[model samples]
Target: MSQLQVSASPHIHNGSSTPTIMRDVVIALVPAIIASGIIFGPRALLLIAVTVAACVISEYLSRKILKRSNSIRDLTAVITGILLALNLPVSLPLWMAALGGVIAIVIVKQFFGGIGQNFVNPAIAARIILLMSFASQMSDWVVPFEYSQRIDVTTTATYLSGAESSLPSLIDMFLGVRSGSLGETCGLALLLGGAYLIFRKVISPLIPTVFIGTVALLSFLLGGNPLYHVLAGGLLLGAIFMATDYTTSPVTRNGKIIFAVGCGVITVAIRFFAALPEGVSYAILLMNILVPLIENLTIPKTFGREVKQREN
Candidate 1:
């Protein structure tokens, strides 16, 4: 008789690894990176490089100090770095950008146990921390080259910042000739990146579709320009990338919908009623905290388990 051998769960392997998945994510983000470099100039690339270096170094040092296995090889630190940089202004001080990267890797990621163990997305957490700590600096938006010809100003308010008098046309917004963060300005690049991720199967479209759909529907119902809302600020970037982080988002289909709808509602509320003009980061952070609850409620019952009926 053959010897009986039983091991741990996840016996079936689909041949996907953390590094492989992260590589795909990096590939998807390349277009956005190129667009940022083109729109924001060489300084944008420099900031991204600085943040990426900072995150990589921070992860290396933190892991060494903590006596934990090195995880930078997994490429998560790189992704975190890129995402954090994209969330920042191109003119932000390099030191501040480096500090944000350190906070993301050392505090947000490693302090919590690293990688999939993190409670919230490290980039989102870092961006929020920087925004709260340096409100003025974070709010400074740079006008792209194409838009500079139309306006005589170097800096301008974001489209969602209630500067209605200077709002760009929908075509310009879609083409990324506006004032915003490094990567959030270009809706076209973000959409292309999102499509790549979806095609590569790196992420599911459920969360992004539901999240953007909810926002559009709510904006339309609330007498706001649905297209403008969809194209403005960091909505596309957040919906496509940050909000869909696997560790911070729900796993079940129904749970994803609930989480996305919640994000949309909170985003609209903050944008329309609260003082904050941009709410994507906050919306995602709030929903990340509720992922555990969402998963608990949505997980399916075990196969072959007997159903229990409640007593009348």
Candidate 2:
């Protein structure tokens, strides 16, 4: 009746595809992007557009030059662009932002075999590169509309960088009326997006939950304000978005928890003592590099065997 067909190991097809998942991630980012526009002004839109275009172009050109199939349709480049734009200051020059996109796509993503083969998140790695290359531009913060009346300047310090007494109220930070990176400023918007991902089953809740909980719990035990730690800077954005990247994170449930906890610990240590104010980028990047190790250590046991016995 029917002929037998041969295929790869993942013969069972799921409804999900690369483009679909990337589309969902883009949808989840919309609220944060809109919130950035409201708080940071029209320039936010320009930066986003610039970076997105740059990334798409870079991906297309890289594929052509490498004689590889064009992967732009998959939208991983698009997500990387959006993430990079959100991490940058609105005041950054368009060219610098575009350059960051190129680095992300060319040096990081494609060079490492593209997509899932990369050892780190392209956007996070690009942000760190940009930060190192343009520290002054990267750290420059624009005053949000809500804070316009209080501050008579174009630029101000971020929450972690500012004096402890002058930090925005927990409410203001939560609502995203404070000054910071375009996307990371709005806690409510990020949470909304994060919840959407969790609802759609695009991402597991375990990594985000453990990552954020570890940060809060550790902060409290170390005499730091837990709420402020959770709401401030890019902690929420990183924990939910960047830290949970499937290619860069652990697969097993136990491995994911360990990866997340490691991220939290590094993040807290950096924020508390490092010269830089925010540590999400580096923390997530470092954990991404160690994901293989984490997975190896936390591999699940056979169904009928003891955990230790399975390992042996």
Candidate 3:
């Protein structure tokens, strides 16, 4: 006779390790990276390299100091770097980009017990911090390649911040021929990457589809251009990449729907009524804080537990 061993409940191996998942996300982001290069020129690539290096070095140093096993191999830090860079203006100084990476990997991520334990999305939080701290640099979006000149001040106003009539055609915005953040400008590239993630089963379509649909419906109701709203700003990037984060997003299907809708509503409200032209990042951050409450309300009850108690 052999004694039985009692252990934790996650007894099955799904074979989806953290490194593998992060790698898949990295692969999915390639199209957006290429689009950024085409739209923003070589500076975009340099910024990405600096930010990624900063994140990797920050994670290594933090873990070494904290006496924890190194986490760079997991590649969460790489994802953080990429996402942070994408959210930033291409003209931002590499040093500032590096600072944002440190804040993301060290403060927001590792200090809070690292990846899975983070309260909000690390990249989003870091980007918001950089935006608040360095408003001028963060807002300095260069004109798109098609209309750019060899000017001293390369910065120009984003289309979303100006009147609708003053903006580029929906086609230009969709094709990423206008000025905006490196990642958020290219709707077509983002959709391609997002589709790959969905096909790879790396992410579900529910949150993104519902989130975008909600935004579209709200824009229509509010007499705004639904297509423009969907194609412009950071809506697609946030909905597809940041909002669907596993640790920060809800686990239940109903919870995900509610979370997505809540993000969409807040985003539309901010865009329509507030001073900010775009609200996807803030909306996702706010919704991420409420994920726990949403999960509690939506998590399914165990089978027969309620019935057994009622019979007793």
- Cα lDDT of all candidates, in order? 0.88, 0.88, 0.88
Candidate 1 residue lDDT tens string, 1-312: 999999998989988999999999899999889999998888889999999999999999999999999888999999999999999988789999999999999999899999888989999999999988988787766668642332333222246554456688988889887777899989999999999999989899999999999989998888788888899878999999999998999999999999999999999888877777588899999999999999999998789988899999
Q: Using TM-score as the measure, name the better of candidate 1 and candidate 2.
A: 1
lDDT of 2 by residue, 274-311 (tens): 87767788999999999999999989767876555456
Writing each residue's lDDT as its tens digit, candidate 3 over 81-172 gives: 99899998888988999999999989999999987999899999999899889987887778778435422333333454436877789899
Where is the poorest 10-residue window by lDDT in model 2?
Answer: 147-156
Candidate 2 at 170: error in angstroms? 0.8
The C-alpha TM-scores of every prediction are: 0.92, 0.90, 0.92
Clashing residue pairs for model 3: none
Q: Which pairs of residues collide in candidate 1?
A: none
